[model samples]
Target: MIWIFIFFMNIGIDIRTLMDARYSGVSLYTLELVQALCRYGSKNNYRLFCNAFRSRDGRPPRFDYPNVSVTDTKYPNKLLNYGYFKIGKRPKLDRLLKTDVFFMPHINFVAFSRGARYVVTVHDLSFLRYPYFFTLRQNLWHRALNVKKLLQHAAAVIAVSEHTKRDVIELCRIPEKKVHVIYSGINERYHPLSAESSEARRVRSAYALPERFMLYLGNIEPRKNIESIIEAYSLYRKKNPQSDVKLVIAGSSAWKHGVVHAVARASGFFADIHFLDYVAEADKTALYSLAELFVFPSFYEGFGFPPLEAAACGTPVITSNVAALPEIAGGFALLIDPHNVAGLSEAINEVLNDKNLQQNMRERGLNHEQKFSWEKCAREVVKVFENLNSIY
Candidate 1:
């Protein structure tokens, strides 16, 4: 039997569900991967670990599964940020559990107890690539030197996209052979909504959605290129005088500061735009289902999830040609230069005017959507675990 351990070092479900949704991607990915692997029926016993502050909320960090058991960095010794490292009065967890292999869903620098194999997943190098886009503290935390150490210590590295794998090799100077590219999988819940009458109305009415409005779903951050999307929408509105166009921006705010409020007041088209600070998983399907078209003009993404989610919901997508957007969109949606406001406006106009193009995009989205599945991702992960354990 293969014995394995997984560590959710930073965040957990409770935090993601309640605290913030921007960081939900990694937590959700870990849950889905674990679920899929459990269902795979491998002769593997899995142990999961995490860290939590204040045990008084009075819940165990452990999630029950048929073949999996979980634990947390015992209370009174939580991980606290110091000047440089997570300097605590006492060591936290310190990889106390014994397992054949250890899988870290995201980067964590904590030293293991002893003699445990390590696998680290690097979702994106945006922390390194777009250093200026982040705060002074985040940049210091995710420095290039820190990432290089993580890469060097890992037995295997998981990159969420090919673009990220390239970044790892170029930025961290890690060899190509050591990197493995694994695409993030969306839940089966994102599939095209069936012909249920209430499903359509509920989703539409909840958002007060326009009969013909475009969607841009993701956190409102600088790297997301929200300003450019708003500009293109404004330009499109100006050109199409009679067209009743609206842009919907959905997702929780990361910084939640003055930028968005400033954009809303300064952009003369405030009535034509909407920004929701939060959207639940169930509501997300409805949001995508009701969208006339979905657009993601992110300046950079390790692997863009909004486009993939929209495609799964049968909404026509228009994303930038940069990073892994093309790799995921794959001729299914209109590709535009993220920096070109006019190009974005034209692409949006073309998609709306051409019925044939819309129908074709819908069909291609269904096909492209098939290329990703949690089952496949889990199988690949299992293979990695098995391969590593076989050495013993």
Candidate 2:
């Protein structure tokens, strides 16, 4: 008698982002997705591939689960990144773990075996859209990746938002059917907090936070439209001199951050504007909850996680109408043109003056936030994998 054994499909993930200590939008997405998959995906085997040398602590994130396993190598990121793009040589990921399907959590993909199918997540085409905002090296690296070719070859493409999906279709000319829109979610730690809450008071004292302040929390970069935000804040202060509310800009400096600083320093209310460099993750929820208003007038975003996080905390938001921001925070936020400093300033003034509007926005924002969750996103992603696995 002959007997055959059936095995679960092995799903290999590129978890380089998770290995890095700093958590950006992409890193956060990777962390949340992995946790969600571990929680709900018991039927499949997950092999998390990491470059331990690239990590600050030189260790991969630990996941104590039966179905998940961590695989690490001492190879540095620069060597692998160059080898893949420059020499067209990729690491033999499939042979290492017998991977059936390799999932890249971000656009960066390392070479794998031909036997294994692959999927990649495109967070945004910011480099393509705002070329001037990036450095020469950054632009060259993005161009070298040949995103068009990557999208064409992948078995499936995961877009973090419908706006990003449309960009994939239009910019890369990829088939609409091949691209999937999976909205990212805010962490459960983000929630509405009472003004008198002990946690809020602690965070406030720790950060030297003002009683009433407008918050802008994210990387201080050129594409974030911080220059416009500063200009608008100046106009707001000029228009409403009696308004004692401060503007608190939190987050680490990125490319062209000096321009933002210069603009802020030139503002008439420079003393009222605070630049808190890189707030800890533990303090983010309190920062959002305590803010009178959260302003995110970004020129473009793949999914706009900050606005969603702010809404989840029941903070009224004012985001730009362009890109995914409109879809993510339309009804909940006062959408305005990012380039229009006067218009943005007027909106800020109006929101500050109207308590009823603020209350309505808070309620609407919290309700809007209910539509997104990491578990729901993970299920949808796993379904895509199952469908592709069955077909290919």
Candidate 3:
């Protein structure tokens, strides 16, 4: 039997990481990886190591399996502020040597851990390739440096998309064969809703969602290209004055509210735009189902999730053709360049005006959604754990 220990950036009672977790893809990836490991750990022994960022929050998230054991620094809140440097040495990897594999969901400190083999998931190289996307202060996290060093030593790496895999190979200089492209899976919570259910109506009442709305789901970061998206929406509304299509932006608002507000208020189409900052997870499905079309024209993504989730719910998608969007959306989406506001507006108009095209994309999207599965992702990851024996 093989033993594995999974390392996440942070986990535990406080949920501080959870607040900003959605903005970081690794947060969700870490959660899903643990769930996958828990499901398969019965056949292959496994345990988990997570940063208890807070000591007394609540029960740590788990999959009702006893094989997963969580270890914290015991004083995570203090360590969080000071980081590993001030917190003294981290939990010793040497103690985990009995385990055959050390799996890191995000790059972090590495302990050779006696004879344990290593595997890591590189969510993206955003920091290395595009540090300007983040604030100057954030671009210099000590842990970020540590994760990079750890990656160089890992036996293999898992990239959520080929785009990210390429980024890793080019930016980190990791070997191409060592990188596996395993996509993230959409939550079962996201799907087309039945008309009989009050799901859409319930969400509308809660979020004050207007009828016939265009949706943009994700953070309000500059990298998400919200300014460009709003510019395109403004143009779309100008050409079609009688259009009742409201442009709804949903998800966590980033550090710069002024920039986001400026983009929204400057819109001549303000009356037709809506922003629901930080929606509840439970309400996401209703929101996706109610949208007229889902537009995710992000500048870049490791593996764009909204378009895939929208396609899963049978919503027509208009997304950037760049990076992982094409790979993740497969052939189910209407692709447009993120920088091309006119192209985005045209794609939006075509989907809204042409019912036949929308229906075609809806069917293709449903088929595309079936191509990804968390179970398959779990099996593939387990293969990495099993292969650690060869490295040893």
Candidate 4:
């Protein structure tokens, strides 16, 4: 008779990032991954840890899974993080939570028992690769966390892409065997929506968006290279004066965002450019569907979501060739050099004038998007936990 061994363990998840009123890419990933984990890994017990020290009403979103429970505290984050950092694994997070494994969906200050193992998901190493892109305070915060040390000690590191896995191994010097590459899934909400739909019309009217505009949705920060999009759009307009296509720059502003606005105002096509500040999640699909094409000229990314999300919504995507952009959107979307303004302008013009190409991209994107799903990611993640638990 063949013998098979099966075991179950308690998994602790630090969910401090989810408290944001407006979730970032990482926050959304954590929320989706956690929900998927509960669904796919129902055999394992889950303990979600969140610290919201000052607000009595503060709580993470409620989950209806019997296998999932929460362990939260109202302790001030600054104090708790500092204590965790200084105390050097004194009060193990796993020990306190009474869990066998702990997982950080994103890198943050953490402590754990010496023998207890935990997994950490690394979405990107942008802060490390392009330190100047972040503020002094941000850099200080990263340094305070000693990110390299944290990764070194992690039982396993979950990289969002092969590019990110390579970065973890080379930059942080983590062993290749210690890192796992698991792609993030496209939310099911991002699919084709007709422009004539009531929701689409409402979003268009709400944002005062032009019908034939190309979109650039992401944090308006220098690292994202928003100016390149503006410059390229201006060039495209000047070259093709009869074209009535407009530019829509959405998403909330971040550090040094004033410069992006300044660039937009200085553009010759400034009148044609619209800044739809902080597009709501519910409106994103409409915004993508209304766009003629989605342009993301970011200089770097470990794994970009907007391009994939835009593509999944049946929108043609034109993203930079650098970083994980090509890795994720290569076969399905047009790629251009991030630093080449004229090239980017030409790319925009090429796509805008080619209806057949646009249709092809839309079809390909929908097909490519099918390859990634949260269920797959969660299953692989659970296997990581199982392997680590088995070793321990």
Candidate 5:
């Protein structure tokens, strides 16, 4: 009877990331995973752990299912992190709740889990790879955590892309077999839209967007290579002086965003560039659909989601060939060297001018987007959990 109870134990999830009102890459991943797990893995019990004090809305994370429960604490994040990392003290998660396995959607974990096994999801190793791009505090936070030790101790590690898995193996020297490559899924609402659609027109009017514009969506961060995009856009305009196409950059500014704005302001065609900061989620698909072409020349990504989302909306993409971009967008979107301003500018011009190529890419992108779904991602993740159960 005791063995049977142990075999069918509850799973605890660290959902502290979801406490934020605005969803970043990791927050979206956590939200989608939790929703999918509740929908598909209803047979198993889940306990969602969150720091209620950190929640943007000051409300506990919501899970509407009989098999799921929420556990909230008012503990501050800074103190908790200090105790976990600096003091080497682990939280008594198993004592507070009878969970057999605890899964952290991100690298930040409660130092100890008593008897519960741990699984962590590593989105990217950007901080280690591009140290100069991150802020001093960001670098210090990662350094304090000792990510290599965390990866080594985890029972299983989930990598969002094959590129990230390889990086983990090479950089952290973690065993290859312990890391699982699970692709993130696009939301169902991101399907292709017609320019004449009501929602599309409404979004255009609301944002005052130009009719024919190239789009770049994501945070204005150093790693995003927004400065390169600005320069490339300037070059594109210079090469086609007669063209009336605009460049639309969406998303809030982050670390060192002044560089991007400075480049754009210095351009001869500064008026042709538009900045719509932090677009709402409901407007994203329509924004993608209305674009003449989507461009993402990022320096690095664990898995590039914006390009994938744009592709799902039937927009032709021109993305970087480096990192996971090629693996994710190859054969569907035009790939270019992110560091080469001339090459990126040329690719953008070529895609925008070629009607036949655009049609072909649209078809291929829609087909490729079909390969990723949250339900499928959830099923694969549950399999990992079940596999861990067999071992324990």
Candidate 6:
């Protein structure tokens, strides 16, 4: 008789992305995925690692679990990045974590040894696809990272969507067999709130949101197609002068946002457009639940969170048909061309006025939201790690 031993691996997790104070899509994925992993992969030892020269808190986040530990250093990021680029593979990150395998929720400046086994998550190749959409500094940052060379050495590449996986296989020339499509999940905290609920009423009062308003929440940047949304909303307002629908824009500002501000000022309906800047986490679901509609018209995305998130809150969504939007939101929300201002304006008018459509979308969205969760994402991620573990 043969006796087989079940192997449990020491998995190193890169928490460098979570060190930033800003709450971005990458940070959300990194933090949530790791939290879920700790819950589900109880047998596997996890080492959360980071490198920061200077931080306001001057400490890496520690987990309260026997299976998890934090191994970090106070080193200048710039110097370490340059050293990784110049020194070939002298400084391996896996050695520092001392794990059987390492996983990066998102790619950044990194170095590895000749035999280092690591899996990397690639969010999108928008920088490569739409280079002109980014600023010079952003482009330079992508170039310096040498994404192509890094992916070539990675043990596996996890894409947030099938659309991104194809981009990796074709653009980076990586084998299709090596790339995995693993989506980021909508938080369970995002759920439908009663309109009469105290929390909902508080969010409305805090934001000064009128009862009838549509929402466009995301980074204020060129790639997000905010210009066209403003133009469409302006035209819509011109058409429906008697309507009381306001547009609430909330999110952090990215690069070249002056153009968006200029367009908003010139729209002649600037007073009706409210920019809430950063929103508090507690108020997010309430705001979504209170909104008449949610609009996300980005030109491209590896995977979108807001559309599904809005749906989870029982709000209707109108998003673009291009890129992963169709794949992600086509079944639940109305799809519009990101560039067609007239069409978009019409879409907004149709959705705002059509209660039956809203009801249909709301039901579909709630059902769709159940398809993704942090537990599901983490389970899939651990399976990938186990495959690598079996080799060692």
Q: Of the candidates shown, which would achieve the greatest TM-score relative to the real structure?
A: 4
Record all residue pairs in model 1 with backbone atoms less than 3 Å apart, i.e. clashing.
none
Best candidate per lDDT, number? 4
Reference-based TM-score, model 3: 0.89
lDDT by residue for model 1 over 1-392, one digit each (tens)? Answer: 99888532211111222112234677667767767766773467666664455344323324466666665554322243331253433333324555566777777545555454777778888877877778876787676237787787667788888988999999888888878888778888887775355876787777677676888888777888877788888888888878886888887676543586577667788887877766766778778877879989888888877798899889899999998888878669889999998999898888888889989999999888878888888778777666666654
Superposed Cα deviation of residue 298, candidate 3 (Å): 0.7
Alpha carbon deviation, residue 135, candidate 1 (Å): 1.0
lDDT of 6: 0.87
Clash count of each predicted structure: 0, 0, 0, 3, 1, 0
State the TM-score for model 4: 0.96
| 1-392 per-residue lDDT for model 3 (tens digits) | 99997632111111223223343556666676668666754565555554554433333554466555555444443454455466545445536324556677776544454444567887777777777788876676633466556676777899998899999888878888888888777677778986346987888888998878999988888888888778888888888888889999987878575697798898877777888988766777888888889999888888887798888888999998888888888589999999999999888888898999989998999899888777788778877766655445
- Using TM-score as the yardstick, the better of models 1 and 2 is 2
TM-score of each: 0.87, 0.95, 0.89, 0.96, 0.95, 0.95
Candidate 2 residue 45 Cα shift, in angstroms, is 0.8
What would the TM-score be for candidate 6 when compared with the true structure? 0.95
* CA lDDT of each prediction against the hidden true structure: 0.72, 0.88, 0.74, 0.89, 0.87, 0.87
lDDT of 4 by residue, 246-332 (tens): 999998889988998899889978889998778777889889988989999899999999998999999999998988989999979
How do the residues 1-392 of candidate 2 rate in per-residue lDDT, one tens digit apiece? 89987646789998888766667889889988988988887788999988755456634667888999988777777877777767888678877867888888898757766656888999999888789989999998888778898888889999998999999999999999999999887789999988789999999999899989999999998889988888898899888888889999999899989988899888877899899988877888899999999999999998899998999899999999999989888969999999899999999999999999999999999999889999898999899889998896
Candidate 5 regions with alpha-carbon error over 4 angstroms:
1-7, 54-61, 85-90
The Cα RMSD in angstroms, rounded to one decimal, for candidate 5 relative to the true structure is: 2.5
Q: What is the lDDT of residue 93 in candidate 1?
A: 35
Clashing pairs in 4: 52-74, 53-74, 53-75
**Judged by lDDT relative to the true structure, which candidate is superior, 2 or 4?**
4
Sort by lDDT, best first: 4, 2, 6, 5, 3, 1
The Cα error of candidate 4 at residue 8, in Å, is 1.3
